[model samples]
Target: MTLPEAPRGRPRDTRAHQAILTATAELVAEAGYAATSIGAVAARAGTGKDTIYRRWSGKAELVYEAVFTETESGPVPDTGSLTGDLTALVEALVQEFSAPAAAAALPGLLADFAANPGLRSRIRGHFLAPARTRLAEVFERAVRRGEADSAVPVDLVLDTLAGAVFFHVGLVGEPAGPRLAGQLAGLVGRGIEAR
Candidate 1:
């Protein structure tokens, strides 16, 4: 499927949409996720609470989209080899998860997810599904090229990479740098490479 078209001409509605997302992200960054609210986001965005409400059902949905939408929208990498593709994808993930806003927002978001199964399911459907679908395409290409085993588990690979980043950054309190991406790709590549 084609990627969604970019907004044209800086329309007012589009501007407001972007503003709300930006405001939500900034608030979550400045104050913890629990502290951010739709009212505050609306105020920061120079809009009204009704405007935010019209776009999102609640804080969790808004914050999830604010923090994650960009991460899921990029072009899928096809760098010829499995290692190269893995490196590119990992680098993007590292860059995304390592961002100050995302790092600050995710813990709170996950906490909300634990409390709300519907929200979690919706989040998975919207953001995670697209990313996984793209990753599956990458893996399918790798398998076709004999660079990866067909038996390689996609979800496990995703969990490992995402888990490592969260653990390394959130628990260890160390920055996950670009170097980590290449190293991670190398290790994951070893496991999936065809015999």
Candidate 2:
């Protein structure tokens, strides 16, 4: 027997979208990647499996959007000086890496990255590329202002700063806050600034 189709004229439920994403991130954080499932997301979100499937094809698409939605990079503001720009950049770093989605999903995502080249590629393209482009803009501006040496390796500096925070978060379990931020800014800034 054929099931009756519902009427087509209807608005998309943005609340359901948000609920699904929130539930996905929380689950990733709580259960790790291997354990987070589409069925679980649907249940936790208080929505039907059909609703989730209608929007997202499966787990990867849903989880990726959940982690990347709030973290996409935009222009980092010119804080007037290189140090200020650097500080702002690091603050953005803290915000991105410390976000609930990233925090919960990273452990599993990194593992997946090692084994799944396609997943790694998607992450690099969608998330890392945008953030790197913005950081490069900040450093390029600093160079134009003559605040830092044009010869300064922006990639290394950025990697160092961001990697340090990642290490502290993943290994030491230290909080990424203003104090740690200032210290990082000072260390990297002192090294990068023209002396």
Best by lDDT: 1
Q: Estimate the TM-score of every prediction.
A: 0.84, 0.71
**1-195, model 2: which lDDT tens digit per residue?**
222463342323667888999899899878877889999999999999999999986677688678754544355768787777777777766776677667777767667667877766776565466666777887788777776777887678867887887888655667776687778877887787665
lDDT of each: 0.82, 0.75
Of candidate 1, the 10-residue stretch with the lowest lDDT total is 1-10
Error of 2 at 83 (Å): 1.7
Most accurate candidate by TM-score = 1
Q: What TM-score does prediction 1 earn?
A: 0.84
| Candidate 1 displacement at residue 187 in angstroms | 1.2
Q: What are the runs in model 1 whose C-alpha is more than 4 Å off?
A: 1-10
The lowest-lDDT stretch of 10 consecutive residues in candidate 2 is 1-10
Per-residue lDDT of candidate 1, residues 10-116 (tens digit): 47777899999999989998997989989899999999999899989899889878886666676889899888888888777777677787878887888888898
lDDT at 151, model 1: 92
